[model samples]
Target: MDVLCESAPNDDDCGTRYSSSSSEDDERRDQGVAMTYMTLDSILNDNSRMFEFLRSFGVLANKYVCATCRKPMSCVKVATTRCGDGLMWRCAKDKVWRSVRKGTWFEKSKIKLKSIVLLTYCFCMRKSVQSTCRITGLSDKTVVDWFLSCREICSALMKKRGKIGGPGVVVEFGESSFGSNKYDKGRWMAEVWVWGAVVCGKDHGELVLNVVEKRDARTLQWFIEEHVENGTVIYSDKWDSYEDAEEFDLQSFAADHNYQFRNKVTGTMERYWKEVKRVLEGGKRRRSGLQSHLDEYIWRESVFVHGCAFHSFMQSVGALYVPRVED
Candidate 1:
């Protein structure tokens, strides 16, 4: 045996090699951790923690004064609590908490704050109210109420924010019908005729659905004029109602698609109509309060645009209301 102890396999060298390998593994793990933290899904999943962490930065506070009485709300209770799913609060007052704003929408709703937050998230995520109810384990009626409250808020916010169109904006407008009745050859069946407009650049538009007596040019034109600004470049499917656009100084284009408006410019508005139809016709029996319920669906659709951060978008929408204090 050349010295009978082969120098113990160079203990220092082996230790150094092992340390180097461990260091490399640690670096790889750190990289993976960094990548995960940078993803939107990860952020959304951890929204509760993120919100709580953000409180330290003073993001949640009693900045909103009551819109009704104009009194400065003194306290804000921000927390993540559970009921149906998980509720995140940005409420005013300490003990018996209430949202800082009021009167515009979501007023006096007894639903848990978490339910509202989850409902809003689902709605923004394109989940229908029925699906939202199922996922959150809430009653259909409660889900409908949440939808209505959201819609009321959206409508109020949009009006306060002003007309959807800015100057020289090309806005596409169209009408579509939803719901059906087989009893009266679908004539006696109540149908909702939806009028919608989409602005080209601004992620802003309006939709109004009602039980229409007819779909004439006057009705269509009135709907367009009410929602879109004058002088917008309007496109429609050769409907006579659109023929009078020249009077309103709106540059008009007639699409060749009959009974179906196929202008790509109008695609967003058309998709919105389709989404509304899906909500109404999807398996569930049409509720008696469908129109009132649909208002929230429309509002939710309008607010959730591509590239918008859903949570922050809702917060901004929430901020649009001046808080109303009850006496």
Candidate 2:
């Protein structure tokens, strides 16, 4: 089987280097096989290939070492009637049947591991649920569930990264309402308030967005305290809610929308609002899991700006599962 090697910073020895001797060539070929697989065809056509790729991350192994006797463990494939039989590790000393996915996202999930990976790929590519379902030949519900799983994982990652703003960082803060237009006289309208803060830095920096109950001063102040760092200049449009920002120990700047303050950051924030609205564009706006959808946008925007959405999305998957400690 042909394998592709991903180049890293150190390219002194790269791309499956070969030697003149037959034995050396065979060794080099084996090393190439060990490298990560990327093609969709390879992953889908060969279940063993997909399992080998995931095994490299220790996903199939129960634990690196035995918890009871404090000894190294070995994992071997066991027969099962499930979607696919996973690895069952036996402690070299204890011989315990430990689970590889007992606590991770895949625990108790009957979905095939390869299918999950493909779902993640499609979601990260920003394909709509319908399109993803069609492409992957998965049911709509299954695709939606996997997409939300990715969003939840990415949300955790966003939280772990902490607030985006620091000293002297230019942060654009804005609040907008989602849902139906209130002006329509004949129809009932329901609106949900959303607060977003975008930090300006290289590669789109970071974004913190949340749903809020109200757009009052107290709510705005709480959002700043929770998501914005101290000493960072905050930008927002002229709104009564943000008037007391200074009192809350925040540096504030307001551009009067009426006067057409065309600052680039403010314009950028407006575009962000537009982009979000466009994503949620439809006649009926009272959608379930709105917050998750918004967060998915944040994750996609951040990764897209860096031009490595797929790589980052896959990395985020690895973060969701932790390796067992070695004794």
The top-ranked prediction according to TM-score is 2
Every candidate's lDDT: 0.46, 0.59
TM-score of each: 0.50, 0.70
TM-score of 1: 0.50
> Which segments of model 2 are wrong by more than 4 Å?
1-38, 44-48, 55-73, 78-87, 90-99, 181-189, 201-205, 239-265, 282-288, 305-307, 325-327
**Model 1 clash pairs?**
66-323, 67-323, 67-324, 68-324, 87-114, 101-323, 217-241
Error in Å for residue 195 of model 1? 2.7
lDDT of 1 at 184: 35
The digit string of per-residue lDDT tens for model 2 on 57-160 reads 44443345677977755544444452263344555466665554555566767776667767776766666889888777899999978887887877777677
Best by lDDT: 2
Model 2 scores worst on lDDT over the 10 consecutive residues at: 253-262
Model 1: number of backbone collisions: 7
For model 1, the superposed segments whose C-alpha errors exceed 4 Å read 1-107, 126-137, 164-169, 182-188, 200-218, 241-276, 279-309, 324-327
